[model samples]
Target chain A: MKIGQFEKINDFEWRLPRETQPGMRVPVVVFASERMLNEALQDRSLEQAANAAALPGLRGNVCVMPDVHQGYGFPIGGVAAADYETGVISPGAIGYDINCGVRLLCSTLPLQDVKTAITDFTAALYHACPSGVGGRGIVALKARELKAVCEQGSGWALKNGYATAGDIETTEDSGCMEGADMEAVSSRALERGVDQAGSLGAGNHFIEIDLVAEVFDSAAALAMGIHQGNLALQIHSGSRGFGHQICTDFVQKFQTVARKYQIDLPDRELVCAPLKSPEGQQYLAAMRCAANYAFCNRQLLGHSARMVFERFFPGAHLLNVYDLAHNIGKIESHQFGGEKINVCVHRKGATRAFGPDHPALPARFQKTGQPVLVPGSMGTESWVLAGTAAAMEKSCGSCSHGAGRVLSRTQAKHQIRGDELRSRLMAEGIYVQAGSLGGLAEEAPQAYKDINAVIACIEGAGLGRRIARLTPLAVIKG
Target chain B: MDANRPFSGFAEVPHTADIALDVFAPNLEELFINAAKGLYHILGIRKGTKEVENIHISMVAEDREGLMVSLLNELLFHAANNQAGEFISLEINEYQLEADLLMLEKTGQQKEVKAATFNDLVIVQDAEGFHTRIVFDV
Candidate 1:
């Protein structure tokens, strides 16, 4: 009968005090506008955030971005910094969609030109890119080859002639995370990833043709090589079954090890061991493999996008603007209370928005902050945001991933008709190559919060600043 | 029994007053019922339970896969955060696979709606178990 109590901190922040829930090691900080907060509270993500704070070895605060929503263990759009030496690693925190991320590619083509051949373009992309259940890709690797991918990530794609150096430069961690152990990865996971290396699986994953619709920060936009009306390709996917298997393997393995270490956990799903512990090391190793796999996955997809574009506009240039990972955990150094602590930053359904000057960002754009690419759902608008100093100083350089889902897929499907949605998309002059009409209905543009609003909130909250807006001209979905 | 009798055994269908098991011949209906039963099983809905509070729950999916994702999300909602009211079961006002799901319901007398974890979901195929984590925030 009563509502969960949450204290308003400021216009953009709220706190769930530790005392409100048992086993809370620190408070939970939520970044949201009041209007967004009302929608956020409609679900249990805030509660999940509070639950995550109770996690052992959690330092600072459990941070939930403006796009917060309920997820498996750690809420999507949730960030938690765990002590490297003693804290635990949750597969739930990293998510089944390990490094399930977004990549933006800028092209020399203009929106009007692309719009004229939307149908042809969508069909070409759909045929070129495999999607949906059993979505087999064009690339395949043997065990040793797959291991190389795990180690080199996007770099592997480039070396194998699947990607270019430019694609690597624009990617987070340059498309690689060192210390990946193939032996640590299960064979089943390896096999699952082998044929699926470059495929785009179903459920919200899409390859969209978009045009820069708006620009909020021209200088940042220029730095990122984005311009109004310039066509772009956005790819959204992850490690697929390989990543899922890794999470499953580690969650079970970590749970056993957690008990061995006598780690007291409020939730079993939050099972983890000290980062330096054998269990922790194994997870980080395996997670790195999955992370790299995801990077490679996107890189290969980028190559596919390039091929698709090349077919349409021969000799045209399509450079990757950036690739950002939304679900991951990494060991990074941060200054907390004036002391630099090496913390394992867990970002679930959240983007790492490292500000300008952070050494981790690419050298050229180091002064312009990391490019935070937020992909909107099919038929909607996407935004390019630059990381902010405040985000670096406060939230461990994180920002909202996208316009969080506002409607359930069922609700979207029920309220919308796939045929009607197709007609509507056609009416908007956008061509869609959908695997299923029902699936199309579920991804209706209305199922999400306004991207403009969400992007505005991120900029308003000082987590990130908008650079450019992307409007879909054509979409290919699994 | 006809070929389509026990619906495709994936999900349970919604019943009036209490959760009922519908024997359908195809997986389509089975999956639909499975969705309903999955929700009912989490809520443990019963008509005799007093209506303590009213909760409006709506879910969206991009397709059948997304529908499964959303259905799992509703189950997660019931399990982890259903404390605001009792566990009055779900009334499937509308249900379509890969399309949409609408549930008209009330908060029942159950004191707790448990948070369903991936570990709680056991997928058995050919006597082998595969673990999966479902993201169900619609």
Candidate 2:
């Protein structure tokens, strides 16, 4: 638990041996600079990462991204793969917000065209997408339609006119996950999800209009349809109450299920069941339902942004770039310990970054790689990166998700006034619209780590390569 | 309002992303009730003038911490369902709590409590009363 305790693997990576803990089944690897490692040493995230290594049937090493932070049992930017046939699946590992992810869209409008109208533009965008305490959703589903959404995901949005075929083609897993069972989802979860589709939930969720500041790799940026100085849209949200309730119900049930299976856990939040067990199957089915719902949720949100852009600049096109999930568990095949094995890789605040040669890449990205969208805090520079095969070899094909939090919300609120923060951002030409000022203050840029450093850690470690950089022009928050 | 007694229990515990509370009471029942009030306190709720509706609630859990999570989540779910509250007449016997939660149709809640979590959660008995730390995923 000290900075000196970790053994350096290179200039950008460190490792804690399996012997670090009594029950650890594998070692823990962390990607960070020396300074970033000092910051993590100040918290308990590394301990949680080691605790995660203790999970049953864990495969390979537990990898922690540079933006790692303390979370519930597992660190936020942590990835762990477990043998599918024998590894246990824990809802906690995937996180409470199932499939919480980011979507990037490119617009044809130039930044100068919307400069004077930025305030009205942000307000219109806020109204276009519902958010905040009293915010309702844009789409309400009937019982039958809800079932179809649970089954079809973005395909449902396409049928409902909220998505285009091009958007579907750019989405990960094509915006729909297989093996989701509506019957496994509880009625309460369904009811909660029915009216909340397309809503941007509070706490670290937002819709940001950014200007592509620079491009590190022209080929990758072109493949992603991102041009320098043009406007782009980033929607950060998830399944809302739907996913939270499912995780709650499952994590609670797994407490006893863990007991039934005689699995010992360091923390109750790490409760899990073997992959082949009935309990795991039911939870996976239910988790997939939430994941699909989230996919459709982002699709509708993107639709709303598209309309806003079209209205402002006639004939303006807002095309999908790519969408990827951070908080999720996927069954993937990877080479580990000298062999290719199937494992359930749980990425909590970490993104899937498959290299160019992977079969999962779209034809357009085969020569570049999967685009990794890392949205920085408001008023900071966001990053666009691509997956590297080094990620596949070192960390189960995963990379950092965002500029992770460094301060508590209460501390952040105490640091500055919401109005003052708004004025500061406005002075920088970043138009801001928030449903709640207190909520706004809590997400101040000072609350997060320097994203540039996190990106450097990724590139220096060879896990991901920077493709482009984006600076915010407008922000809508819940 | 308690005309004869002061409201004295529970304090906020700082968490990086979520809301956490440390509740203390003279007994198990009071601890459960204090936990609920602390949750509403964090929500910054403003009660309405409508008549209160008495809601019956009952459940059992394996231990004190389990029961605590169950009780707090029950209130959180009610809040998400748009039912505002001041829960009363709480009783506890061997890890089971029975109470009538007073719910109002209208109340302005400034914050949303997503769900209670079991992360680093614990309930312990001391000479003064019961103590536990609860984290809510906001």
Candidate 3:
């Protein structure tokens, strides 16, 4: 677990061969600059990546993104594919916040037109979008209605008039996963989901208004409806308590299941069952329910945000650019060892950066690529990148999700004052609304790696190409 | 309040993204109580003024680690429902846990913990006491 142990494949790629660890079934391929590689060594992320390599029926290699940080059993910003029929599905590998992802909404309003009204605009959003710990949503659903939301996802929103047809077209999987089973979801998860739709949960989740500072690929930018100097809104949230409970319930159950399957993992958190097993199917069905719940959750949040924008700018419209999941397990076909195979790709803190002409992408993006949203740390520049064909060949069409954390929350809170940070951001012309100053302190920009460097590594590795860069105008956080 | 006594305690541990806690106690029951306190600490919770509500829970798990995760997740479920529990009493025998909790209406909380994870979780008995590190998805 040191920088020297990795065999340098290039400036942006390194390989920890399978021989480095006894139980590993595949090599761990990490995409990072030398500096980022050093950062990965600071935590147990590389070790965790190696641990992930040992999962049964693993295919190709375990790919680690530049933004990786140590997460429970699997490193955040990691991707691993396992054979569909023979491999295993791990809840820990997918993460607790199932389908935690980002959605970018583009607007026609120029930053210059809304610069003076940011404070009120942010306040309006803060009010319209319920946030903070244990904050309820705009409407609480009955158990029966919650089940529909779980099964229908954003389609449920479309039926209820919260989403437009265009929104569904732009969403990944049309905002619904096909195999979600209400029977597989626990009643406890349904109870937790009852009042959580349309909410922006706390802990690294936020709603930000940004100025499209620059466009690198005008064609891709235009395709995504993002114009330079215009404003865009990004929503970062997930399935809320519903997903957490499902993952908790499954990860606990899978411990016994793993033993039953004779799967010996290096860590208990990495417990898993064969993808073909009844236990695996049940977890997949349950996980899909949470994933669909998250899609609907974001759709509702987007609807609320659009209402706020319309109220502020009268005729303004916030159009969906693209919505993609950062944490998910998808059965995808990819070339492995010169043969195409269906594998379950688990992306934790990684986005699916599908290249141009990929059939999964909507027709509008066929000429360009799927838009990959990478939100930087607070007050930093976020990037909208286009997926590249090279990504399919090299990293299983995966890319970094965000500027990963470097400092612990406690360390950040100890080193930075939330009030001072807010004042400083305001002085810099970035309006800020947060639930607690203490919470704000924990998300200080200094706590994360340099986003620009992370983006550079992505481009260098040919995983994604920049389309536009966005600078924050206002931020609302839980 | 007695659960927050001297022989058992918890402290925050450094984790890159999530919050982690190292809890230590002289025995298994104390360890579970201290872990609950650690969760509340990570939440930055303060006691409420409402009348206390008593809750009783009984759970069976595959092992001690499973039992610990079940306990913390139960506490998290209660916290999400607006009732933050203070441990009234806890008993651990084999892989089963039975506990009585005094629940307080959640009044002030500065943070949110998604769930407690079993990542690298192992209860070790050493010369000092029982020690384990629990990582909470934030």
Candidate 4:
């Protein structure tokens, strides 16, 4: 509950021993600076992390990133690996926005080349991509088409001419998770998915036009198609209402399932079902449907942005850099304790940062490692980092998602006026377009921790290595 | 909106990453109604000019918390479909809940809430009334 209670493992590593918390199966390993550790103690994040460690059949330790903050049941920037055979899977751990992730598309056009058209470009993108509360997508899907999206993910996008081969190749898991059974999804979730394939829902989701400010590693940047002074686009969203419904359905159902299994948890939100149980398998199958839906959602969004890019600048192309999910549950083989074993890695508000030579990565990134896109708060610097081999050993190939919230939404809204925040951003040469001023105020940069410090902690812990830093030229938020 | 109502009201609470509301009521039905109003407030929803349509909802759950979550999620489902429900009448008995609502089209909404989470959701009844805190994933 306090910073002084943790056992200091190193400058950026601290451990809350299993003995510190009753019923904890493993220690809670937190990566943070002394200041960050204190900041975490300000909230219930540490306690949530300890709760996560108590989950059944946990392996290694519950790894909490520096951007950690209190989430529903588990800490936001938390990673826990459970033995594939005996562990339990909880819907709350993966978050409501199933594959809530980030996608980056780098273009060769330099910022100076598009300086005059920045406003128009931003407006065009806003029109191309639907955003805000209850914003319908570009195309409404029938039930059959929605089913295809649930199973094929970006592959469906490719067939429908909304995605490029390169885009699918660069996406994590090639944009599809296997074993997503359509029958497993509820009709309500299907209805929600039918009309929200490409819409960017409100609350901290955005499409940003960024200028590559600096390149830390030229080779890695080149591999990721990021160049200094050039422009890039970032899409941050998820499976929309579809994922929300699936999670809600499962979390509700799991309540009874947990009782049936006699699994006692500190928080009701942490209710889980055994991995091999029929209920767990059904949830997994349904969760994958939402995951694939999110992958296709990002692809469609990228396609729309690409269309706007082509219309504005003739012959210009938006290349998919790398797309990865921050919130997900995946079966991955890792070196735990001594031998390599398969475990279900649940990353909630965390990104998979597979280092170089990991077999899961594509051949193109075999040497450079997976690109981890860490977007800062609006008007702040976003960073592109490469996964490190050290991450595989220490943090279950996971890193912080973004600058975690330090203030509540109500606090942010009360402190910062939306119009004033917009004016300040405009003065800084960062063009802004938001659905609602109140929503804009809730995501003010002041409400978040220092992103630079978060990245420094990641680097300090060798979880990831910085390759490029990006500054926003324009931002579109919902 | 009903903060002045004796023994039944709702207020926003501070949460790091989501929207949380503290609600209190004299009974289960009042608690459910206050929770619905609190949800709409968080969403910043404004009523549309369209005519209201009447609808009824019936649900059965395992316990009081389950009943509460089911009621809120039912409201959210309608909200997601562009309808905002105004409670007309409500009834509750143990684990079952039934309500009549006047549904109106939602023309303006500022924020989007994903789901209502059960994190630390404990409805407690004391000498004054019943009180609980609900955290919504936004």
What's the C-alpha lDDT at position A294 in model 4?
A: 96
| Order of quality (DockQ) | 4, 3, 2, 1
Per-residue lDDT of model 2, residues A1-478, tens digit only: 9877789999999999999889999999999999998888777889999999989989989999999988878889999998999998989999989999999998777787767766787788988899886456889888898888889999999998999999998999999999999988888788788898889888789999899889888878988999888889899999888898899889888989999999998888889999889999999999999999999999999999898878877877999999989999999999977899999999999999998888988898888889999989888999999999899999999999999888877888889789999999989888898878888898999988999999999999999999999999899988
lDDT of each structure? 0.72, 0.88, 0.93, 0.93
Q: How accurate is candidate 4 locally (lDDT)?
A: 0.93
Positional deviation of residue A154's Cα in model 1 after best superposition, in angstroms: 0.8
| Model 1 TM-score relative to the real fold | 0.80
Per-prediction TM-score to the true structure, in the order listed: 0.80, 0.97, 0.98, 0.98
What DockQ does candidate 3 score? 0.83
Off by over 4 Å in 1: A1-4, B1-138
Model 1 residue A451 CA deviation in Å? 2.0
Instruction: Select the stronger candidate by DockQ from 1 and 2.
Output: 2
- Which residue window of length 10 is worst by lDDT in model 4 chain A? A132-141
lDDT for residue B6 in candidate 3, whole number 0-100: 44
Enumerate the candidates' DockQ scores in order: 0.06, 0.62, 0.83, 0.86
Give per-residue CA lDDT, model 4, range A286-334, as digits (tens): 9999999999999999999999998998877889999999989998999
Model 3: chain B TM-score vs. truth?
Answer: 0.92
Best by DockQ: 4
